[model samples]
Every structure is written in structure tokens, then in C-alpha cells.
Target: MPTLTLENDVRQFLGSITRRERRFAAAGTLITLLVLVPVVAVADPGLVPGTPAQSATEQAVDAARGDSCRDTLPADTPDYVVCRWLTPPQDAAAVAAFWGADGGANLEQAQPLPAQYVRCNRKTDLSTSTTCKGGTTFCRQLPSGWYQCTDETNGKVTYERYVNGKKQVQSTPPPSPSTTTSSTTWPTSSPTPSSPDTASTPLPTPTPPDETLPPDGNPPDAGTPTTDPTTPSASVPTVTAEPTASTTPTTPEPGNGAADGDFIATAKKARLRIWLESDLADDYLAGDTAFTAALQQLVTDAKRTDVTGVKFADNLAYTGFSTEQQVIRFLNRATQALRAALPGKRLAIGVVVPELGCGDSQPCITGLRKRAPLVTKQHVNRYLRAGDVDRVEIAGGLFGRTYRQYQVTDPKTGKPTSITPALATRAQWMSVKALEWDTLAQIGVREYGLAHTGDTSPWTMAQATAQIEARIGTAIGLGASTITLWGHKATADGQTYRLLNAGLADNPTWNGLTGQGLRGRLAVVIDPTSTERGAADIVHYAKGVSEIFILI
Candidate 1:
């Protein structure tokens, strides 16, 4: 052997090996074909093997012509035009994946091998080959045995099924065509399709009947049979409703103030007072016309109703008088007028007498004492006349005194022990009690009365009431059976009574006096100008008073 060059030696070796390998391969192929041919011939005649015998050129032509093995599928399948078999490896994997390692043996035992493995007999074109018992072919080419079925008409692969090279059996299906035809013809206007229409032609409109009757005439009744046919009976019955009566009372006419029986009973039981004063000066009196009118009306109303008694203060002429004579004259005239006007009713005169010591003096007790006699004599005579005055009240003293002597105090040795002298010894209350008592006695006033000083600066209603009660107690001690309380009224602290009767009924002191023959025996003289004055008078009188009277 000579030394071989690389290319030459390689060529020679390859040529020899090619010849040997070709002979071996041919032998193996012949053996395989023989084995397969017998199996195919003896196996189900419907089963065909190998790819359909078609030229590469012919396959190209058929594909371009849209000639597909898909024609073998039923027309109902969607996109049946694109159905085709899967490749060998994919089919084998599918079978192995589904049935495990023994899947190949089971597939072979099955009636036919898949169409993808069957070779076509080229002499028979699709026309004859397509009608094969177990497989379908087009133009001498076998179709793929596995087709991926899907809903897409665009031929998208969704899922696959291995269709062994076999044809389906034919059976008599239900009347599906007729059913589908009927269902598809249903109304398209609605969401769900409807069945086709089966109705016949509609009838024509009827003509109206002829009527020759009056405008208000009734129509013929359906139940009644026609005889003369001149008149028709009523179709509906008529109903009449009955009227109803109201139970509410009718309102009275406008002019009627109230129903006759609805009036409130007048308060026949009266225990209050009405005080009238004309002491307000001419100008002042003119301005108080309404007050005068109210006073007159109150008196008239009180007289109209039942009352205990009435007392009028007749001292108006004394108002605005600077001199003692002027005051005396005014008091006399007022007393006369009051007596004439209220003849039966008790009338009292209020006197304002000035203390002389108050004029340019220090500790004015001496000066007050000097002027006290003259002042007392004038007012006592003027207001204490018989038939002219019922009672005399000493109104003013200590007109401008701040000294406590005007107030009552206990006497020292050699001093006057009487309350009047003791009270007067004080420049402040000079001649207060003395003038009150002396005036009542000198004028022959049987019913003695006294009012607290009108100067309200130093005296309060409480103090005044206390003073009045003390004086009344003193008079009773002096054998005076009937005494009147003048000035200062009880105020509503909600503890006192509004009426004299109520007060007498409630007070313990007055209750005790009731057994002493003094029940409703003491008279009360109230100054109507004061609010607490009236109430205080009521409380005092109700504690055993014959009458409650207001002195104005």
C-alpha cells in the first residue's frame, strides 16, 4: 500500500462503504415492505398504510387548488375546509400521553392505523381513492389522520383528536333539518329567535247598524226578547242616597256677648276697699281725671255689689296749703263735702300739722312743743266736728326732723310716762299721738282713728303697721271697744291674706279676739294710694273687724 493522500483515501473508503450500506439498506427495506404488505393485505381491508402515492408536483397543485382531505368531514363541522392530520411524532406523543407505555400496542390492535401513516395508491386519483372504506384520500394522496377541531373559521388549531383511517357509519338522524328551518324563521326582532308564523289572513271590519231612534233613547237590553220592538228596557238601575244631619251646635249671632246661661256669677262676697283722694292740687287733680273716674267707677261698682263698708278721706282742701288757716279751711270744706256725699258711710279727715321747732333750731324738741298746741287746736276743731267727720287722723309731724326724739322712747325719772308725751318729747314724732287722740275726743268723734305720719322718709310700712297696732292695743286697754287702723297695708309675701275675711280666718290672734266679742268688730281704714297700705289694712281689719274700708 502506498501512502494515501487525505482526499483520495477518504473518497475511496466512502465509495466502498456506500456500496455495502446500500446493499444492506435495500435488503432491510425489502424485508420491511414484505412484512408490511402481508399485514396490510390480511389486516382489515378498510385499513390502508403509507402516505398516499402522489407526486410532489401534484400535491403542490392540489394545495393551490384548495383541494384538501378536509372534504371528507361532515358539512356541519365548522371550518371543515382546514381539517388535517397531525404529524407522526405529535400523534405518538398524544397517544403516549393519554394511554401510557402500552398505548402503541393498543393502537396497532385497533381496526386501522392512522391515515397519516397509510401510503396512497397513485393509480387511483382522489375521485376513486376518496371513497375508501377505512380512510379518505384526495388526488391519490391520503389525508392526515388527526385533525385539530376548533370553532374558528380561520383554521386556528385549538384541540386535536386521532381519527384512525376509517369512515363514520351512517344512521337515520331525527328530523333536524325541518326543526332547524322552523326555529331559524322565528321573529328576529326579539333577543331569542322564534318560530315561523302560522296564522291565516285577518277578518275585515264590521259595518254599523242603522238606527232611527230619539237622541236620548236607550239601547236594547241583551236579556229581554223583542216583541213590539218600539221601546227598550233600562240597562242599569238608578240609586238615590239619603241626606244626613249634623250633630255640632250652631254658633251664636255676633251681637250676643256670650250665651245667656254662660255668664259668670258676680262676686257678691266683697271685703276689699276703694280709696279716693281729691287732695291732689287743681293742676294735679286735672291731670288725674282718669284716676278720679277710676275711683268713681270703683265706688259705683262696689256699691252695686255687696260689700262690708266704705270710708272716704275728706281732706283734699288741705293739699298744697302753706298756712295753718289754709289747711284748716281746706280740711273743713273737704269734710263737709265728704259727709254730704257719703252720709251713711264712715268718713275720716287726715290733718297735716307742722311742728314749729323745725324752723332754724338745733335739737328742735322745744320749738316743736311750742308750735304743737296751736297746730293741734286748729286741725282738731276743723276735723273733729259731729256729723262732719267720723274720725280724725293726725297726719304730719316732724316734717323735717332727723333727731330720734320724733320716735317714741321709754321715759326717764320725772319725765312723762304716757306714750303720747313720750313720743312727742322726741322732736321727730312730736305731737303725733297727742294730736291723734285729742282731735278725736274734742270733735266728739265716737270712732277714733289715727294714721302714721305721711313723711315716708324715716318710716316704712312695717314700722307704720307696728305703730298702728300699738296704738290700737293702747286704746283697747283704755276701755275703747272699737278702734280703726289707718295707714299702711299688708304686702303679698304670699304669707298674708288678700281679703279681710281670709285674714281673720287664718290669723290666730284674731281667732282669740273672736271669743272676746271682737270678731269682725274692729274697722280698718286703708289709704288706697299705697300698695302695701291696702294689703296691710286688709290684714289688720280681717283680724276682727266689722268692716274693711279704704280712706283716700
Candidate 2:
């Protein structure tokens, strides 16, 4: 309006503002231009296009999710920088470029630098340690026996030298074979000289019946038999009886032509058994006369039906007794009652042996005890010495199912409390399992089951199936000849039993006993409540044992 001739020379005036101020103004103008983008384009000479603006949050997110390589020097490789990802060759090319390479190289082609030159600390935990700590300074192999971890934060590297999963430590040279005594051998059922050359003797061999003819069967008269006395009496007209068909055994088959009572015979032939808790048979504890009567009746009923190895188990921890003598008395009474009911049949006396339990409660004797495993071993050893225990039925309680959390009533307050009976974590469970099996195994008792009761976490059918499979597989792997399951009543959906069915169907050979009635090393215990379909599955797939014993 004042007739002022403005040159409109922005560059000439831009120098008037300080460099910092000019930059701010340029930023603001650029933002404003972007706000109204495509609507206006100022065509000014010597003006270069500006990059689009981004908010701090957006920039940060981009950076976090960006594919740019990072400074990873002093790493396992001198030429390689860490990339957000280096999977595809195309992506790895960018990673390679960060190392001043012409292009990305194959990730598979990358070789790690030597780790021997830079020793770090050994890991105290299962994880390989990377730094020296606890007076140690060497990255060693993990229990997994795969990679060696280093404590060094920088230049972390792993050297692989595969060996057995558990490290073999040589504390001292093993005593020379000549220097060793013969005491290491497991004893036979019959007593032998304590220091007999036990190392060379095999396990007791089963003796068949004498082959001589009965006195009732008049042998060829002495007058007619004049051959040499050493000639074996003309071989006594050797008889060759035809072998029984595979489907037929000394006992009747369960589903083919036998009654439910025949399940007893089936169980005996298969070495398959099912047992309910003593409470299930009768609310019995400490073996009172009533309890003894009830137990005897239960065995009598089972024997009447043909089941011979039937068992009724109770938690030894809940016996409300302290001294081992009292416990032994209880077991002895039960054994006497059973023997009175059935004279000579073997009974696998099942007992819920726990290393820890409620100090004084219905489920456990309310105080905390540390020597439960040892006590359990002692209890079994005592039972064996008592002469009625055929096999020690080790209930699954804590050792069998790791996924369970048991609830018990606090005797003093009458309140429910949750307890983790054994190791809860899967890793811990595996470790404990190995130890538990070894403990019982070392005692040389015929151990039946690392069996489970029905209590478990709510899991999908597939999950339950997999877990049962894993549990059974683990028990078998641990040298358990029989894998028993209890507590089917805990799962209402029948998923656990169904999953068990699927496992049996998947592998009949796992049973170790089939229709042939030839006893197998692997026996799977079933619940009395198993679905009809589940039972059929076991019967169909049964290899060594076609019969299943229900946990009553």
C-alpha cells in the first residue's frame, strides 16, 4: 500500500536469521506445506524439496521395527553385524552390507568364530555360564550337552562338543575289576552265600515241573524194562502236546468268551492290575477289625471273580502314626486279612508313599518330614521281609503327575490348603522322576507304577492324551515294567481316559502283554471307570496283554 517495491528475495533475507532459527522456520513451513499437501506448490528458484515430516512416536516405532543392521562388533563373527532378521537371503544381504560387503551372503554360509581362545565363566544354573563367577572361570557344557555358553556380554560365542546328556565326571579311577568284590550283585529270591561269586550268576531261572511220570501211571514193568539203567528208561514215550493258539491262554479272555469275573484270570496272565483306594473299598485306615473285614471281603469278591492281584492302597503319610512299628503293624494286619481270604495268590500291596505331606491331617500326618523317601524305602523293605508283599505299589501321588496341585484340609483350622507334592515345573519333574525311579529301583523291589490318580489340571483332550503318553513313556523309559493310572474320577469329561485309549490304540506293543498271555515287561493300568470305547481300544490294540485291570 505504501508503494514499497519488495524484492521477494527469501534467500537473501534467510541469512538475516541465525542458522538455528532458520532451520526452525524451515521446519514449520515444511510442516505447514505438508498439512496442505498437493493443494499448494511454491515454485521458487534454488528451493530444494524437503523430506516428509514424522512424529517422534512414529519415528521410534519405525526404528524399533526397522531392518537396519546394528553394530555387533566383538561378536561371534568379526564381519557380521546383528540384523533384526537375517532369514531370507534378500534380508541377509542388507545385514551383509552393514559389514561393508558387496551383497548379502547366505545365512547358512556364515561360520562362527572360534570360542576356545576366549574363555568365560561356567554357569551354575543349567544354562551355560558366560562369565567367571563363584570362583570359576570357564564356560562349560550344559546338562543338555549341546552348546557351551559364555559369560562375556561382548563377543558371546558357543563351541559345540556333543557328549552324553549328563556330564561324566571322573572323581577317581574306578576300582580295578580284580579289586572289586562280588557284593554288588542283586540277591536272588532264595538266600545265597553273601559273598558268592554273585557277579557271574544270572537272575534266578524259573524251574518247570518235574518231567517224571506219576506213580499212578504204572511204568513199563521192571521185567519188561531190561535196557541199560543209564539209558534214561526208553524216553518214557515222550509226549508232544500241541501249543495253545495265540488267542487262547491258561485263563479265559476278557471279551471273547469270558464273564467280567474272568477279568481276574486275564489280569493274572497279563500281570495287569487295577486297585482302588482303601477308602474306595471301605473308609478304612490303620487297619481296624472292621477295615480288615472289609478288605478281606473285597479280596474275596475279587478272587471269586478270578482277579488275583487286586490291591487296595492308602496314603501311608495319612496313617496318623509316627513310629515305623505302628505302620508295619497296620500293613501286617492288612496282609494277614488278605492271606486269610486267599491263601497263596500274590498281592501287590499298594501304598501312597510321599516324601512330604500335611503334618497332621486326613491326607497326611500333619508334620513336615524330610526322610519320606527313605522311610518309604524302609516300609517296602519291611513289607518284603514280612513275606506277603508281592510287589510294592508306588502310587502316582506326587511323582506320577507333575501337573497336579493337591488340596488338603488343615486339621487345626479345617481350611483347604493347596500343596505341590513334588516338583511342579516340567524340567524339575523330569529330574525328580529320574531320581525317584532310581531310589525305588535301587532297592530291588518289584515296583509297580509311578501311577497317577485322576487329579490333574484342566487340559484339552489332545493335551491330556499327549501328557498321558509322555508320562507312560517316561515311566517305561525309567525301567518301570508297569505303568498304572489311578484317580480317573477326578476328570469328569472322560478326556484323560479317552486320551489313554488313544495311546493304547496307537501302540498295543506298549502293553507288553497280548492275547497270547505271554507276560510283557510293559503293563498299562486302567481305571475302573474307563469308557466302553476306551476299554475296547485297549483290547483291540493289546499286543502282549489283551486284558485291562480297572482301578476300582
Candidate 3:
């Protein structure tokens, strides 16, 4: 065994061993061949005293390939290139320990085997060997939420359980992925209460826009207004989104800022809030005339489309930080202008939390907690108390999954504090599962294939779809009323993989989840540019949750 030509050759040997071959090898020394190894043929039955001769077909079938299957296929096997269940050994230890205590199964003494010697069985499929026609066991789906796996060869039967769309031999339900429960009090604004029965209540649906909101809902204006509404004056410096000619309502109406008709009504009915960061201060920052024009255009567009909410936050779009007084002043002025533009509409102020990445040592969970609390107590709380805004929000970058299990280290001392997944989740900046909040639940989404995440493997369409579904579950499972799906159109070999705008509704996984009772309780984010696939998912998601947040 020339120490096996390659590492893959060793795995092939381990995967191909059969009980029958073991018996044959006992009668002789090692047989070596680069191609499929030939086995010993039985002698004539007439010459043997009590032996029965096997038919030609039986002999050929027995000699073809062993009926043994493994959790995965060996890399050197012929089908390894195309096998759907190809699972590469995770580490050197996994490869060395695969054969348990069989010390002789190492590379030096092992011979690589061909594909016909073994079959790859996926974790979901409980079916036995493909070649063992008569002796094979089959798993059948039953109505009782359990599977019946029957070994036809021995007439033996056993029950298996299906959990989270995967087949398992165990009977108990799987534990929650978070591995811990929180006793923290629920936020007052939580869409669903933390009670056990809270899942039963349907989330409140957004009222129809009375056929207004631009492209999707707004109706054309009847005519232009007789007078342009005056811009409201603010004690602090203010930059208002210039009112567009298209938005001036021809008729004067009353009720809920009806004079602001299409704009005010649309915002109220859709329950929308647009986040505007640093735009109010751009003129003061760099004297960028175009920047001011852009802000005006954004407001003008919102009014024309009947969008009502505009938020002001520092550090969202700008990299530099402004003084606390500057932020407060800007908020006051921006809110005044927004109220004047779209009277009776909601006004929100936001704070953009900065991301602290894994430095020389992992970030301590305690330190991470300090960050959120400091932001809330010092920055967000004071503004919320101002009583001028209808809503207060915090936005920031999410930590990638890779940091979840990193070794936590003290920021000042740079010493190891703890190296555990539980603590890491609590420490990560963007992981909602780890963070504890008092006033608001962060509504966000997740993505894969980005740098610095734990996941590094190339993604298949199936894997990507599964990931999106998992993210959806995690957000809703954590009591998120709204989820921001952060993803992009990724292409591999001419196929696209994405949660939004990637034609995912046609995917079987997406369609299967259609009526799983996810609607009303979960609001999903959608890209405004997703006119095709996203539109369909938005409609379905909105039908269930009552509203879809459009990412502009």
C-alpha cells in the first residue's frame, strides 16, 4: 500500500470495505490493482457436498458492488464529482478517525476503491443501498408526523421523526438554536406579546392607501393646488425637502392633514417611515449644493408618492460624527420642516450605531452590551424624550456569523475572557439573538457569502434558499414584527440565488412555505427595484403580514 497515492485514495478504501470482501481477504494476501478489484469466484456446486449454485444473475449482482452506503461518498469514487451528497471531511481528525479504532485502515495499508463499491445516502433519505434490491430498507412518510423505516430483508420495522424538514431517528424535538432563553421584559411596541398564545393573534395589517402612493397605489392627481403651502420655520437650522409641483393637491380637503392629501394619506395608510441620515446637515458639512438638491428631491418625491415619514439621524450616510448639540439642532429643524411639509404625518429620529469588529481579540459580550446601552441611554433616549418625534430608531451594521464563536478578549488588557458561542452571540454587534433591548426590537435581515462570516463554502441555490428561510425563521422566532432582508442577486453558473427579486417564489422551498402560517406575524423587506419576482413575494408576504417595507 505505497502509503496511498493521495489522501483521497485513503477515503476511498475506508468507504468501499464490505463484509463479504473481508471474508474473501481472510483467505488470501492483499490484491492490488488501479481499476476495480476482482473477488474470488465460488467453485462448481456439484463438487461441493452441501452447496447450492448461484444463478448467473445472482452471481453478477453479488459481484457488481457491495450494497453498503455511507453518510457521504469518498472523493475518489467515480460519482464523487457529480454526487449530490458529497461531504468532504471537515478536518484531518475526521479523516483519521472515520474508521474508529481500526488502526490498520490508515493510508499506508489501504487501497482506493471504485464508486460501484459504495452508495451515498443523504441525511434526509433513509433508503438503504441502491443495489440491494431484495434486502434494502425503505422509509415511508406517514400521516402521524413520523416515518416508518422498514428493513424488508429482515422484516424489521422502526419509527423515525422528521424535524425542521429533516429526517431523524430520534423522537424528541430539537432544542432551539439560540441554546438559551431570555427573561427580559418584552418591549411595549412589540407587535406580538411574549405570551405563549401571542402567536395566535394576527399582526395588524396596514390600511389601504385609498389608492395613493405613486407606482403601486397612488392615483393620478386631479389638479394643481391654488396655493403652495408655506414652509414651516424652525428655531434651529433646518433643510426641508423642496415641495415638487406634482405633489400640490388641486382640491383642499380636511382631516388627517388632508391638505397634504396624496402624501400625508399615503404615509398613514402604508405605515411607512423613510430613514434620512445626515442629509439635513450636508449643506453645513461640505457646502455641497447638489446634496441639498438631492434632499429636496427626496422630499419632493415622497410627497408626490404620498409618503409621510422622514427620519433624521447622524452618521448614517456621513462617515464623520457631529457634536451631540449639532445632531439635536438638526433633528429639531428637520422635524419642523417635515411637519410643515406633511402635517399630521409621523416624524422619527434615528441614531446609527457604529460597528466594532473583532480586533486582536474577540469583542467581549459585556463590552457590546455597554455599546447598545450607551447608545440608547445617552443618544436615543434623550431625543425620544424630546417629545417632538413620533418614533426613535437605531441603525447599524450587523456582525457576520463567523464571529459568533470567536474567543472573547478584553478591550484594554487584550486577554482572553471567554471563548464560547453563547457569549459570542451576545457580544456580536448585529446579532439580534444576543442583544437585549429595552424600548425597541431591531428589525433586520441576514446574508451569506460576504467576507468575515463563518460561512465560507460556495453556495448552491438550494443552500442559499435554505439560508434565507432560516433567517426568516430566526427573526420571527425572536419576536421581530418586521425584518430587513439584506441580500443581493448572486449568480453561479447562470443561475441566480437570492431571497428577493431572484424568482425565488418558483423555488420549491419558497412555495412549500406559502401556507405555513407565517403571514400577519412577520413583515418582510423587499427591494423597490424588484418589479418581477419581488413583487409577487411582496404581495404574498403583505397578504400575510399586512405590510412590506420597500428598501429605497
For each candidate in turn, give its C-alpha RMSD to the true structure in angstroms: 59.7, 30.5, 26.0
lDDT by residue for model 1 (421-490), tens:
1122122122222234443532211121122122221222232222233233323332233444432332
Off by over 4 Å in 1: 1-310, 314-319, 328-343, 352-377, 383-387, 394-403, 406-412, 415-470, 478-482, 486-521, 525-543
TM-score of 2: 0.34
Write candidate 2's Cα lDDT for 1-552 as tens digits: 333334445656876775435433533453343334322322211111121221110111011232121211111121222232223333333332333221111211232223322221322221122223332222443333223544344544443432222223332333444665322222243333232112343322212111111111101100111112124422221111211112111111122322234334445554444332222222244246656555644664556534545454433433334445545666677677776776765555544434322212223321112323214333434544653566554444233221123444432355654432211111222222323433433211111222122222223333222233333332343234454433222122111212222333322212222322333433444433333343443453244432244544
| Pairs that collide, model 3 | 212-218, 213-218, 263-306, 402-454, 520-544, 520-545
Compute each candidate's TM-score over C-alphas: 0.31, 0.34, 0.35
C-alpha local distance difference test of each model? 0.30, 0.32, 0.32
Could you tell me the TM-score of candidate 3?
A: 0.35
Candidate 2 residues lying further than 4 Å off, grouped into runs, are 1-289, 318-323, 356-387, 397-478, 487-498, 501-519, 524-530, 533-547
Cα-based lDDT at residue 384, candidate 3 = 47
Decide which is better by lDDT, 1 or 3. 3
